[model samples]
Target: MGKAWLPFASYNLWSQFAPPVGQERWYCDMKRGYAKVRKREPEVTAILAEDTQPQRVGLLAQRGVYEFHADAQRLANDDGLAQVSQILRLEQESHGVKERLNQILSKYCENPILLGKRIFSLSRGDEGVPEPIRIRCGNYAFHLFAAIDCIFLEPDGTLHILDFKTGRSDFDERQAFVYLLAASYLYPQRRAIASFYNLELCKWSEPITATASQLNAVRIELMRLAQRHEWEKKQYRKNPVDFERIFPPNPGFQCKHCQFNRICQFSTREIS
Candidate 1:
């Protein structure tokens, strides 16, 4: 099988290179756990969906936002928000999700669509946009890929990449930067502004801009990460069955939220 393309590996420095000293077993457990679910295990997805309800609601709301604006008739439909809000109610979640969706619509409804595409765009173009833009670049080298939440092309030809966050979890600025970097590669001619919108807090992040120099730095880092990842894969291949000696685990606080914890052999007491 081909090696996996791990985008998060770029930001997670600790687990990227190797396991922490004397934690070989933990690394093996982590690797094994990931292997079992590499093909989208239904149980893992269901468990994760349950754990991240706010995120699910946020994604649904985002889709509603795109559909509402895409269809002129949707403007008059008072039930646009309510239709999406119904799922949250069925889940017995608080009214916060419904309120947050309204807040996001109110904030973005005024903007015109220069380029209309779904949440993620795999290919980039100024015209004839497609839904679900899945960015799959650097295939020969590192295989960088990402599904963007949304991309807006302003009248001035500037690109706005907005990622919606519904949960109260702290936003990782790196995620936005990674998307921005991908946008830079996909649309080099246009300048881009990337930000995070916290629907729960009804707050917008200060926009971050990316220039040619900044994008070049990102490219260099990605190349280095790709090389390192390949090296790790080679190490694993040396002893495929002996993951304990090849890919040791680094069990710690992060394990609590890890989807593979149930399958993890490592013992960690840090469960919040």
Candidate 2:
């Protein structure tokens, strides 16, 4: 996932890195030139988002999954490499397009692709970060992984937090609140900025507020899920949830836009 930014829907990239800065510029005094700038944005509308958490973006991205049975009907139903390759291409191009958007933002504003495939620094006191805490939640332990995008430190060291999003639509404050909870845990007492980047539209938001009330809700959810996960493991000694029960894909706009419609069981059943 080189140059991986809004480029695609892969979570690994989001968790570890971001899109390339197409253009970059000077921040603060413009004293020291920003070394990572690529393509530049002529105008700045909001705070710089640290990045997109893969789960949130993937949840709303273009996805199509097909599970083919190996029964007689499946004999002639094997997907050729072409279709699979097509899927690969879309993911690749989507990633590239996302990178382009990142480039534009970096050029226009002082936003930097701050975090990349680097170890989460946890050393404290001497300017180091500790290992990220991983807690199991509900029955969904390991449900999502998150990281801070950037801590825009003011001259006086005030902090503003921002998040990027690559969803085709549905960019709002809700998702930002999720990351804000994690960021708040990492950097307590510092007021933060949480916003979404609709890279498809090349537009970011202003006043994408981060609220304590919302962050509290996320914390509660995480805690509750962790407790549930503990109970399930002790009781079942394995995953207790059924795939069909937890992830029943109801026909809707997401299904309609799925790329694997032709071979999907749900699609065929709907047509029949």
Candidate 3:
């Protein structure tokens, strides 16, 4: 017989389970319930299909960077920004998206961050579902999905994992830690660091690194999160009606921005 599949964990799941520092007031467990547990439901599936404005901007910004670095000449050419805009078909996007992307692309053309580094990998950001990193913590085994945006080697030989941001979202150190942990497994021999860069704000976070013990602690925490998430999923499957009980809601003003607000009965706002 085949072995049983392990539960999965990612920074996305971690954020859903627990909000970033200072954002606790807006955290809602029911949102995770809808987005992860009952996502296969038609109503939920429909809502999840559409990307929010912020999400669109972030994806396009990352894609713009990818396209710029794809061809080195684009970074040097005077009309590089315009060329990439045409390639992205920026005209098709909404005004907000187009304007934000134009700024991001223009800035990247002016200063391509990865220009001189020996890049190990750079994702276009639309690649669905990165290959999972199998992790075994104590008796628990689970998959760790980390979609790293970019990785390059420093002159000193450290592997640097760089995550890109678009909007005003704060840099979640947990995400950098997760990438550091993933790097530990992927490049067991190489020392690594991780950081975030906000394209819109032209901001860069200080590099983040973790020791062996810290990475192990992160692994254990993810294992626990995976087990808890799987348990919640099983409970919901056993009794669909008990979803709210299993994943209680904290409806408030934030629901207006929640992707699942349209279908969530507990949502505070009446999303049109």
Candidate 4:
């Protein structure tokens, strides 16, 4: 699928269907269309990360943590890894990134259980893999924007997908399953596992591993979602401004967190 056709009825979107808010699907379509046409990123102003650490913590968490994992994996492989300069360079680039990274890395490095693991991406290494793992199955496509925070490649070839959470909020296991689904496609030959790590709470979740059959079921679901999204997208292209009927909105509490809530008629009760 083309970049123009993203936000394609993602798992999260499908899960949001319900009530009066879901009734205004058209409004949702218009909001998505406006974003695509204008080439704008989703607005994140409404979201406030509870951590005292700056917003940069999250961005650096992805980059810095990946760097750490790559270096550690390379070292395990006896590939003559060079992480000191890498860490130094990262620290020099920004003020808080290094400090935040230390807090995260210390937990892993200090723990004896986490020391021996070789972390790697399911598709490939950090150097070449795309920022968000994009998967396309026919006309229906969904971008896996949520990167797996850390993946441990076991000796037996099991790929463990780990997501690092900095906050205290309850963990959502579905997100990890999404990564596992992506891994199933990216590295079909290997067995895959998924887990969540809460750095703030210092807790590790029970491991969840999916079977080939379960993953195949998810793949089929995604295909159906993609086809339906493609059909609706055509409707959106025909009349971008008036695509309300096809992509109706179900305005309600979800609007409060919606990036498009500011411009949605059902939410604001005013003309856009």
Candidate 5:
């Protein structure tokens, strides 16, 4: 028989369950339910399909970097940015997207960070649904998804997992830890470290490392969260009327920015 499907966990899922440091006021569990649980619904799917401006900038920036590195000479050539822009079809994008992408491409052309590094892997940022790493914790089992942007080898032979950023969002250390945990499984023999880089701002975060105990704790926490999430899903399926009770909403000014505000009954904004 085929293997039984298990619950899944990721940094995204963790963030949905709990707010990041200092952003608690905007936290809303209902958003999670709309996004993850009932996402297959027509209205929800339509909203999710639309890539916000920030999302577009991030994706294009990552693709720009990938294209630059794909052709080593582009880093040094004066016309490299133009060539990459053509490849990206930047003209077809909105003015904001085109302008921001041009800035990112220019910055990368002037300072190609990965020019000489021994790149292990780099994602173009458009790959959908990375393969899950099957994780077994005691009697519970769940899948862990860590879509790392890049990986390179350090001089000391350590594996360096690098995540790229584009917007003003703060670097959530939980994401780095998730990547480190995945590395521990994918490269058990090698020491691994994770860090974040804002491609737009050219900002680099301090390298993050974790001990075995810390990783174990994260694993257990994810296991519990996965189990709880699965239970919530089952409850919602059994009684759709209990949706609000299962995933309570925190409607406020933040609802204006929520993608599902139009469909959310608890949304503060008028749906006219």
Candidate 6:
């Protein structure tokens, strides 16, 4: 139930978040930054289901919004209570931050793209996509990617991508720009931006827009990346998930609650 692009991702609470490489780094760092980090949901359930969110939101995002829900009942397993405690702590802290951010956003602006959220991957579908598109970049030299969570289409037909942010105010413009490029390449007519929902600040910024030339360049880069991976895969003959040589092994902020945290090679010191 991993994300379409995150071949490296495994399920935690049903594979809910399926965070891309960048987010994985974020997660690892969170665990290290806070000793209280823990697992929020059963890896598989969260990874594979879209029914976990509120019905209204779930229906709005039919593609899947399930991320490890730490508060669910089964999380009470006597084993690994310490880890579970960490997950609960992170989730609650996240909730508090969101409340504050929303309060701030409520006063300054109206909804940017009213009810225009759209998701891309359908991990919860029982039938696998017959011809699902696979995205690869540079024989592991490139970061695997996926887009979901908050597709805000402006009234002027510009599509904006919105991602939820639970912590500080950092933004990844390259990632969003590539998404914009991808949207233009794949959908042709739609204009998309990877927008952020600052759960703490409740503010919106003008998203980075990929110009025609930028989008074209991205397409070339994507093609070259795919070709490079194709050659490496042919030569190495390893599962993409298990392939590690292409990208240097670097763990970052997102691993704290990663399902693979237990097994990530860089997990040298235990975080208890």
Q: In candidate 5, where is summed lDDT lowest over 10 consecutive residues?
A: 263-272
| Residue-level lDDT tens digits of model 1 in 1-272 | 74554433343342334344454444444444344323265655555445344554666556655555555555556665455345334346456655655666554444423225333332221222222223343563444554566776666767888876665655666666767877766777778888877655666788887666776666566567656555655665675565555456677876765555675566364566
- Per-model lDDT: 0.55, 0.37, 0.90, 0.56, 0.91, 0.41
Off by over 4 Å in 5: 1-4, 270-272
Write one digit per residue (lDDT tens) for candidate 5, span 3-99.
5677999999999998779788779999999988999999999999998888899989989999998888888888888999999999999999999
TM-score, every prediction? 0.62, 0.42, 0.96, 0.59, 0.96, 0.44
TM-score ranking of the models: 3, 5, 1, 4, 6, 2
Which residues of candidate 6, in runs, are more than 4 Å off? Answer: 1-146, 190-194, 238-248, 251-258, 264-266
lDDT of 1 at 80: 51
Using lDDT as the measure, which candidate wins? 5
Candidate 6, residue 48: CA error in Å? 9.8
Query: Each prediction's Cα RMSD?
Result: 7.5, 20.4, 1.9, 7.7, 1.8, 12.3
Please count the clashing residue pairs in each candidate, in the order shown.
Answer: 11, 30, 0, 17, 0, 37
Order of all candidates by lDDT, from best down to worst?
A: 5, 3, 4, 1, 6, 2
Roughly what TM-score does model 3 have, to 2 decimal places?
0.96
If both were scored by lDDT, which would come out higher, candidate 1 or candidate 4? Answer: 4
Better of 4 and 6 by lDDT: 4
Q: Please give, for residues 1-272, the per-residue lDDT of candidate 2 as tens digits.
A: 33222111112212112212331110111110110110132211111122234432332221211101112232233443234234324344457444443343333223223222121221111122323444333443333345444345544554555444454545444456656656665667766565554434546676455567765566555555445434433443343343223223344344343333433344333532
Residues 1-272 of candidate 4: C-alpha lDDT, one tens digit per residue: 64553644344544333212334433354444444332243442222222334434555545544554544563344322235325536546455666655665555444423456775743212343344555766565566544455678878878888776664555665566667887876787878888877664568899988776876666666556656656766776788675567666656555655556665666744333
Candidate 4 structure lDDT: 0.56
Kindly report which residue stretches of model 4 are placed more than 4 angstroms away from their true locations once superposed: 1-57, 67-114, 122-146, 250-256, 265-272
lDDT of 3 by residue, 130-235 (tens): 8888999877789999999999999999999999998887999999999999998899999999999998888999999898898888898899899999999999
